[model samples]
Target: MPEYLVAIRSGRFDLAALKNLNTQRKDQISPLISVRGTSLQDFDNFVDDWGDRLFYLDISRQPKDLKEPRQQPDKPQKINILLERDLNNPKNAYENKRSFYSEQLEKNKNIVPVVSWRANDPIRDIARCAILLNKGGEQAIGVRIPIGKNGEPSNHSKEALSTILNSLPTPEKCVLIFDYQHISSFPSTDEDSWIFKTLSLAQNDYNIERAFLLSTSFPKERPDNGSSMITACLDWEWQATLRNSFEILGYGDYATSDPDGEMDFIPGMPTIPYAGYFSDSHLIWWTKKEGKDKEFSKYIGIAKEIVRLDYFHDDDFCWATIKYEEIASLGGGDKSGYGNNGVWLGFRINQHVAAMLNLANVNDSQIDEEIDLF
Candidate 1:
């Protein structure tokens, strides 16, 4: 099992962060790539670029607003047509349909399909899991159990898990992901106990091979001011708490992005010139109103401020820090571009992953200090 399971939406920046990781870092992480809407194509491209790497693939429930109205056959008929298609034949008639995702899974040995135990439609989820397991080995499946509002497993999660597991073979070999998404603060003792109980159930009942706790404290709303720090010690503290009780659980979180995931920028709205850097337990941000200066100059300013911060990791810290220094040193009059929001997000996520990996070697005292701060 990998040391860390990082969850990231299948966006250009998120994928780029993973792809840009150094070899040693890449080897330590197993990304849980969540694909939604047309971003499925982006995930496919990432797979092509990254080559063979063990990672989890979750086809997120597409938002209703984002769904394009396309003429398609009924669900059952579509499934039958897809299952009947020639697996070996490269040119299948349903290539343009939703079966494209399943086909991608069939061809990619390294990609593990993640079936959410909190799914609204357990039947459809079960069928999807069955198809993927039948094509891609049964060993390559992950059951994601999301935490509900009361900080415990969702009501339907256990029932859904039982149904899905009974339909598949070698359920014990399947990985388990317990996702406690978007915690506003460190988990209380009661919440921790609830999580521990759920994990114990998984271990005693399912005898699963591995399990991971996933979460994030990144703010859902954007910062209201020019520069501020957001304490992101919630996930770390929760993991530490759980590890004290349940020693076998692995670590995972939504890297840099908020737990709600990425959002598209409005075309007409003005966007602030901003940069975010992930330190040990905080997200240090610098921002300025748009039109205050040239875009490159604003970024350079932010970079300079970031590098000078007390918590700033130097240029050798990671690939992102190197780029930060490069931007910091550029002349204001230079015509070179500093890239857009996507590029900036890539930098934050890349550094965030490196910081998370470094957390493993951190002293217990230092971790306590981090948890106590803010």
Candidate 2:
């Protein structure tokens, strides 16, 4: 069976009521911890008690009632029942979460911030958590790995990870958290499975500690009767180990701004310190594939370009009005363009070098002078 994290909230209930709920949770889950408030030591104590099954008690708010109760429960009971079951077997869930985190920590010592762009946007907010690899904080490193071009890990996720890991400072320690969206990027190893194998191999080679990978992309659809295998494949054990060394730096504060529907910006890419490193104007440019509608041109720019544009208002940062003839002379205009796609452009930017572009505003004239393609 799969394990989960179950949060119990205490409302206006008296001690007896709270006790009853706790008892029920304990019965549902073999081992449970009592959390009266939020304190590092208190949370750690609960973590210690439950081993991997430890969780939070949201007594500050009243426990909400479930509409249908559980999928297979009596009428009076109302709550996400499976969550209760996971509370009973939190070890499984914790371990899976821990495994990926530990792997990230070992690979690099910095805040690894990742982002997952919108489904069609080719940009995602994947990471934005700080990491403390060792006891020292000065030697910290930060990273941002884009999990997807639009809304998933990009085709070059492995290469992106490798690049970010290599750029960090040496002899670093970390306190990390995998923001919400980046966690989903863990399961698959690309079509060739090179990234997965490399990560697994690297974990053993380096004894890393403390990390977290959070995301909305966890296994929502599991095969029938393959629950056990699915959990194992997800590497639950390793996840727990990683979680043991992690702290919930904090969840992102997101509020929607859409009038019809609230479109919230969840962190989709991997976040590292000095994230805007790749946003240099020189690294930013638009390209169009050859042979496609010369009229409907596609913008092929670097991640830093997008990040810089986003940091400043769109009106402030306009695409350089260069002639197609100029872009075509470069790599993107002809039939034998950058890639096979009739109109696909790409940016070869990473986190470290991009940060320099932060001054693009103060030095717009200089930036314009710095970047000029044929």
Q: Across residues 123-191, which tens digit of lDDT does each residue of candidate 1 receive?
A: 455545444554434456777877766676655776666566665555566777877787886665453
Which stretches in model 1 have alpha-carbon errors above 4 Å? 37-41, 62-65, 69-102, 117-119, 123-137, 166-168, 188-192, 281-296, 368-374
> Which residue pairs clash in candidate 1?
none
Listing every candidate in turn, what is its Cα RMSD in Å to the true structure after a full C-alpha superposition? 6.6, 24.3
User: Candidate 1, after superposition: displacement of residue 70 in Å?
Assistant: 15
lDDT of 2 by residue, 183-262 (tens): 33334434344333443433443222322333332223323321111111122322433333333222110000001111
